[model samples]
Target chain A: MNVTTGQSTDAARAIAAGRRSRRWGAWYVTEHRLRMMRTYTGTVVIAGIGSPLLYLYALGVGLATIVDANMGPDAVDGVSYLVFVAPALLATAAITVASEEFTYPIMLGYKWNPTFTGAAASPIRPVQIVDGVVYSVIIRMLVNLVLFYALMVLFGAAPSPVGFLGIVASLLGGLAFGTVIMGYTSTLQEDTGQLAMVQRFIVLPMSLFSGTFFPLAVFPIYLQWIGWISPLWHATELARVFSYGYAEPIWLTLVHVAYLVALIVIGWAWSRRIAVRRLNS
Target chain B: MPAPVIVARDLVKKYQDFAAVDGISFEVASGESFGLLGPNGAGKSTTMRMVGAVSTRTSGELGILGLDPDVHGPEIRSQLGVVPQSDNLDTELRVRENLLVYGRYFGLPRKLVAQRADELLAFAQLEGKEKARVDALSGGMKRRLTIARALINDPRILLLDEPTTGLDPQARHILWDRLFRLKEQGTTLLLTTHYMDEAEQLCDRLVVVDKGTIMAEGSPAELIRAHSTREVLEVRFGSDHNAEVGARLARAQGADGHRVEVLPDRVLIYSDNGEAELVKITEAGLRPVTSLVRRSSLEDVFLRLTGRSLVE
Candidate 1:
């Protein structure tokens, strides 16, 4: 074994680890997860850049022509169907990223690979680990949202001068959905394809029935309840208001903002509690 | 003990109705290599967790580095480095990155950690393999990397749980050498292993634990002197006749200290002069298929105290 010549005494370094922890612990953990994400950086970049382009090309040119030719180019909200649909696609992108980021990796951290236990042993708190995971995902989500918003402009889908504000609305929407899912994922001890089940049963249905491509009023009142409860619906409505100046009651717009923020708060707190219980046990 | 770094008294941990770690107490002083010797499910890991400040205790007291784990957990943990029983290296990261990232968790500076990671890689004898994928390394290399990762923060106390349990002899020796160097460098070591040879080789003092309680506590030689004879004569007879032979040996004239234990395949006779005692036993017409005399070991001490083998 080759050790360095200048070995500082152990006591000094040990005290340094403790002192630094109270200030920068969460950021360090965030730094670690981001490095883990870098292992598959190619996959994330390709999927982030490629998927949004495909969604826009398909819906903007192909589907917009059919809908506009029949509905006089203002079928919903006095905008082309593609323009109406772009924000929903971006919001769904966030959810897609959320589900992929939250489930199996969280399980891996806790059990399979148990990297979280390794983190738990350090001076950093388990709640910091939870914060770190969330921060890492938020970083990815923010990156994806910016790229998707750029593409939304390239496709001439976002027409309002302030269409860029949709990025913030979409990000908040994503967190509202992702954080809640993260809280649930952190509590899971067994996988058993449960995340896949959530993808198929909950996410797929929410995307289909949340009025992503059409006005929620088009659905019967009973089916509209799906739109009411779905975070996707809340996020999409907020993004629509920003993307194309889509008008609704002021109170209704406030409701959309309130709903997503509430879920983010609840889910973020739940995940922290779960991390404390599991890591400290 | 001089300037005891870790002090625990009547430490208890329970899960619902069952106590995983019942009232166990021990103290480890600065720079000492201490051990908890026990079989699987003996709660060695639980006690290590409590002392490591990763788990909360249900009752009793634990002071690590003069700080309480309940309130100063992060502070206590900062002074300790933990190598868990199993490797949890991030397969997503390269070999060197595992050390760097772990150092980051302790909130060390990136520049400091970078230099320390290289030094640790050298200390672990994997200097050129820094960029290798974690899964690409051999089990021995991975274990070494895990150990290196633990040292990234330059902790005062290093907590290892069965550090060499699954390694081959050569690999185990390599680890033992690395650990010996740490001990020489003034890093207090607290490890747990069921291998008596491991306890004897590494531990300056140890507690014999069974079912979450300490059965005995002392240095290896002291425990041996207290619980085992100076020599142990192992004699194997036909499987069907060993118990009967053991009974005869227990009462045989001029044989042993009169302490004999009958195992499934062999009989153990305890005496100060094993060779002479063996001669007396054979002369008494109690012959065996095979026999050997060896110095008493911690294994024998454990058997004497618990009426069971350490590994079984």
Candidate 2:
């Protein structure tokens, strides 16, 4: 009985230590997040919000006239071309923020400065370091998404109460992309143009082919696979299903959510291992 | 009596195929200022990393505060303060915020962190610059802030890895004084420095390491006396002269049967009495352009054993 109690006490001590380490790690992440926000908030607001707005004006207003005239009055769901593209724009903005927040910042934490080394030298453990970085990125993504969503409302792109659920979908999409890409970033050693390649070859292709600006039915059968696999496509489809009442099978929606959640779980486990190797080794 | 604050036996650390710290072992008694004195790439930093519980050793027994680093790294690290070779201060935060945030990493209460920051700032001589950003501070100021941040936990042992490497002479002196005060207050210090004078001035005992192994270990005076003569006579014989003076000086012997080393520019005559050696050099008909006698030091001891210049 005494031995069992001692073992339980040891387990309790370990639990307490783990909690303390996580608390320290959270503070470290908060400081990094706040510093990033203070320094880059203006840049993000301009690029994330302003760039999307400019793209919307230039593409929606300038090019819409010609496209609308060709496709006839009923071509765009009985709405303006601008309205048809607005929700897609919001989803795309969230994905862009996720890509930026996940890649270079994750690399910097692991390689450039190794802030984790200093933190781990304290009471914080390697796993907490990983958690802290992920938490900070999530917070940044949420803030950016909220701001973008607010701008969408201002532009009258939100069609119903269910339209607000698009922001949550966008967030889930961001987490899907961020987690998977962060795993890749943690394994990289050199500052190669690989991230740029991902942006150009992967993200751009997915964005252009995933029916963000048009319906997937308009695409060739071969190209339709892009929408089926793209997280942005899944998110935009879910958003449109909620916004315009486009019908999707319930199992299909579950598949979309499962795809994202599965990626997050797998990426999280891989990231934890990478953090331990990079730090303790 | 308290147990040894640090203990290592056959500790080895390898990076791929290269052994950075190859089976080195040593101990530091509590409250003693221990130094690892060596040239650049002599594995001093690697040894300190193992002791600080930041770098894992490949094989061997290691203990900090009587606990194994493999099992008790976080616990050991919490009780130890480390100042790395580089000033990795957060450039975005104010000087005081760096200390406060670092203290928070140790899970110290915010009020206690604030109080400790003030005390450490005063100790590091940066009390007035608390509000200034880290990037706005000078190199010396950044180094001082790093030191102050390290002390926030009031650790049982402090490890400094080449703390004065890039600082100017005046800045180095100030840092040395602060470290001396910490030593006086009975803080156990383990430092690595390539500067022999720094090791001599601050370390009560030190190990001279090279190629990841200890060459000698003792107090500075004791190591010098053990490996070198009491005094050394330096003779420079212009650029043109070489082996002729060397042959003559090699033939001449002092009362204690000491020898001389001849180089292209100078010849060092080792003996018990440097003045007597100077008389012998004159009598041997080798007129030198310059001559000086000085007491033997760790530099001389290192040169004798390594056959290489300390600074090079």
Candidate 3:
């Protein structure tokens, strides 16, 4: 207990002489979170590459083969069946990745690990922590999109040069979905299987019913409203327009962009407010 | 005189109908080691959180570094370091990374943060363990890292809530030593603790809080001197007979000025001279299985003020 090398006092005084900068602290949190992400980089990369490849094979190659054979080569929208479904898959991948990034990790930030509290105690504010987490998740989404797109190109699923625009559409869809999940996470006091409920109820249902695997027109009109409300469908429609020049009215395309943008903006606002309130309390 | 680093005037924190902290007022001066001493749920932690600028007061005039917390929280927080009751270290980061990241949170330059991280690791006696994961470290190591991380920004004031709560005696001593060094370097420290010995060792001035109110406040020596006797004579005459002996001792003529407190396991006879008082008790034909005379501590003062043992 009395073990002293006398460096502590000198170090303490040195620290006392240290200076503070007014630079944005959220980037520091983002850097810290990014470092944490590195620990799971191997798994993240594998899953990023593997999931899209499998989905493209199963949905685009396998399912599309059967659908195209039944309906001819220009089956759904005068493009290959693989291309018709590729954009939707990209949007679904983004949403699912966003769901994973936002839910359990946000819960961990609040409950499991409480690393956010440590950040809150510093000069960094709660809003910055919220921003930092969202920013890092977006970074992850970008990487995931890159992997998904590379696979789409490999399988000849993405044909048009304009397909690169799907990247923006896919990322917007992710942010819109992720921010709301984050906002919900901030209100959680305990796990109690709420996240599992979200995955089972909200995420899975949205993925299945959001016209990811098939066009919304194929669904009965009664259930087609799900596609209208779901951010996945909005992004998928936008991505399809970009990916294969799938024709759509300009106003409808504007509506898709507007809906996803609205969700992102509102979700960002709510999550920031809730996170700051919870951290302050 | 310069304003104290922290001042709370009738601070209140309410959660629905229950008040975690009710109308408590206190001041902590610059470079002074102050404490909020109380058992768990007594609002010591709540008070620390408010002073740390993380928790808002329900209704009160509060100031940190002469700045209003409500109006200048970020600015005030920039000048303070806080070690919460629980270790909230980023378990995902290595020990050194923890310090570096915390420094970054203060918006320090990356190179400076790296240099400070090295120095801090050494100061925490964790130099060799810099690359070790926080989860892999011992409880003591984690605590030291937390303290080291807090100092990364050279905060004007350091707030610690139960800093050594779960540590072993050896670890506690090491932490105390590090805190002592920080104090010697003129860092203003505000800590909360249920440990009476810890308050005595660290705080130059402290307030005894109970049930969301300040029971008493003074330096350890002053508090003990003012509230408790110079010494205490503790005697156990079997748990069953303690109350009986206490009643007799209370009624005895010569022990009039002394205070006798009966406990479940023993009887405490408070007097200026405990040895002499014990002699008097022995002469009264009261034989005890065991007895000890020791100087009073902040624990005695807390018991005197609150009518309950510090631990209880």
List TM-score (chain A only) for every prediction: 0.93, 0.86, 0.91
Q: Write the per-residue lDDT of candidate 2 for residues B1-312, one digit (tens) a residue.
A: 655778888889999999999988888988999999888888999999888877899998887766677776777777778898987776656788788778877777789989999999988889789889788888888888888988998887899999999999999999999999999999999999988889988999999998899999999988988899899988888867756777666776534478667766778888889998888678867688899999987888777778776787
lDDT of 3 by residue, A1-281 (tens): 11112234332342233223224667777898899899899988998998988888997889988999999999888987999988888888889888888998888888789988888877677888988888898898899898899899999988999898998999999899889888988899999999999999999999899878778898889999988999999999999999999899999999999999999999999998998888898
Ranking by TM-score: 1, 3, 2
DockQ of each: 0.44, 0.33, 0.35
Alpha-carbon runs more than 4 Å astray in model 2: A1-19, A22-24, A45-52, A55-84, A111-114, B239-244, B251-256, B259-265
Looking at candidate 3 chain B, the ten consecutive residues that score lowest on lDDT are B65-74
Selected candidate, larger lDDT, 2 vs 3:
3
Would candidate 2 be rated incorrect, acceptable, medium or high by CAPRI criteria?
acceptable
Error of 1 at A19 (Å): 2.7
lDDT of 1: 0.88
Q: How accurate is candidate 2 locally (lDDT)?
A: 0.79
In order, the Cα lDDT scores of the candidates are 0.88, 0.79, 0.86
Measured against the true structure, the TM-scores of the candidates, in listed sequence, are: 0.96, 0.89, 0.95
lDDT of 3 by residue, B1-312 (tens): 645767788999998899999999988878999999988899988888888878988997787765666655666777888888889988877888888878888777789989988998889999799889889999998999999988888888999999999899999999999999999999999999989899999999999999999999899999989998888999999978888987888777334777887888898888888888888888989998899999999888888888888887
Model 3 deviation from native, Cα RMSD in Å: 5.2
The Cα error of candidate 3 at residue A266, in Å, is: 1.8
Going through the candidates in order, the fraction of native interface contacts each one reproduces equals 0.62, 0.29, 0.50
Clash pairs, model 1 backbone:
none
- Cα deviation in Å at residue A26, candidate 1? 1.4
The residue pairs in collision within model 3 are none
Question: For model 2, how does the per-residue alpha-carbon lDDT over A10-107 read when each residue is reduced to its tens digit?
Answer: 23343344355455666665665566566777887688678767867776677677778888644576666666676677778778887887788777
